[model samples]
Target: MDETRQWTAEAARAAAGKKGEETVVLDVGDLFGITDAFVITSASNVRLVRTIVEEVDRRVKAVGGPAPYRVEGTDDARWVLMDYGDFVVHVFLEEARRYYDLERLWADAPRLEWDEHDGRAVATRP
Candidate 1:
């Protein structure tokens, strides 16, 4: 498994366990310079968003991953972003997710696949 994909998968699965919806892992390594991958997830409300973020953090840490370099939007409750250097995590509310439309903006970037049955994340294509 690619190390970065493993991080994103762990984050995605953690968020999903917390009831996060629309979870996606995008391979943005070739698209930009700031990060290699992105793990995006959405929740229904602010509280759920917070919960998802916390759960993701905990799960990632449980896997012996490095802590995020920076975390933002916990109080704002709009869109929380956790920067872990190699992979960035975004937990957003439904409206904010649609407004930002990251999936559309980064449409050119290939998506990483996550197998829920096995809990693995892999980059399958460009």
Candidate 2:
């Protein structure tokens, strides 16, 4: 996998390590020029949301991925956005995730499948 994809998978795994649910990676490079992909996941509560965000940052950095250029929504912890230039990590509370439905918003973008057991991108789902 490319560096961006590797970093995205690491972010997803980090979120999942914090028990983040419904983790998915969207290849939005074709549709969104600002970034190549999005790593999205949901947590059960505000605390979990924060935890997932922290874990994602730590793990990604540990793997030599660059720190997020900017992070937003930490104050609310409902939907934190971690912008890393090439990709962004979205950690949200269950309600916030369901409300925003980013998956539906970018439905046309192909889903990059990650191995649930290891958090490695295995294939792309059209």
Candidate 3:
């Protein structure tokens, strides 16, 4: 995998380790120029949301991935957005994720197949 994809997988793994649900990586490079992909997941509550976010940051950095250019929505913990330039990590409360529906918004983008059991991007969607 390329560096950006490796970083994204690490972020997803970190979130999953914290019990983040429905984690998915979207290839947005063709549709969105600002970033290449998006790693999205949802937590049961505000605390879990924060935990997932922290873990993602820690694991990504531990793997030598760049720190997020900016992090938003910590105070609310409803929908946290961690912008890392090449990709963005979105950690959201279950309700917030449903309400915002990023998956549907970017339905055109191909979903990268990942191993929820091990948190690896196992294959690209055809």
Candidate 4:
């Protein structure tokens, strides 16, 4: 796998650990082309959402993931988007996840699964 994908996955893991959720990493490289991946996960509440956003931001920066081009819906705390140039992260409350249906929006893109135990597993389409 490429280095950017590796960093993004690491960032996702950090966010999940901070927020305590089941996170899914999606490979959007085929669809968007610009972004290499999307890290999709749910937060139980506004506090969890904020935790995820902060965690992702801090870890990504620490690991040298490119700064997000933009972030949206942060103040509302329902849904927070951290748009790293090569990988966009969507941290959503359960309702927001269901309402936005981002999984369905990028349904065509392949799912990138990870090994929760090892923290090194990665998945992508050829």
lDDT of every predicted structure (CA atoms): 0.89, 0.90, 0.90, 0.78
**Between candidates 1 and 4, the lDDT winner:** 1
Off by over 4 Å in 1: 117-119
TM-score, model 3 to reference: 0.93
lDDT of 4 by residue, 1-126 (tens): 476666677777877788746687888887887888888888898988988888888877776667788999988978788888878888889988899998889888778766544345467553
Off by over 4 Å in 4: 116-121, 124-126
lDDT per residue (tens digit) for residues 1-126 in model 3: 478888898898889889999999998889999998899999999999999999999999998999999999999999999999999999999999999999999988887776645535644663
Better of 1 and 3 by TM-score: 1
lDDT of 3: 0.90
lDDT of 2 at 9: 90
List clashing residue pairs in candidate 4.
none
1-126, model 1: which lDDT tens digit per residue? 376777788898988889999899998988988899889999999999999999989988888788999999999889999999999999999999999999999888888998765556767664
Q: Which residues of candidate 3, in runs, are more than 4 Å off?
A: 116-123
The collision pairs in model 1 are none
Error of 2 at 65 (Å): 0.1
My TM-score estimates for the predictions, one after another, are 0.94, 0.94, 0.93, 0.86
Model 2: CA > 4 A from native: 117-119
lDDT of 2 by residue, 12-55 (tens): 88888889998999999999999999999999999889999999
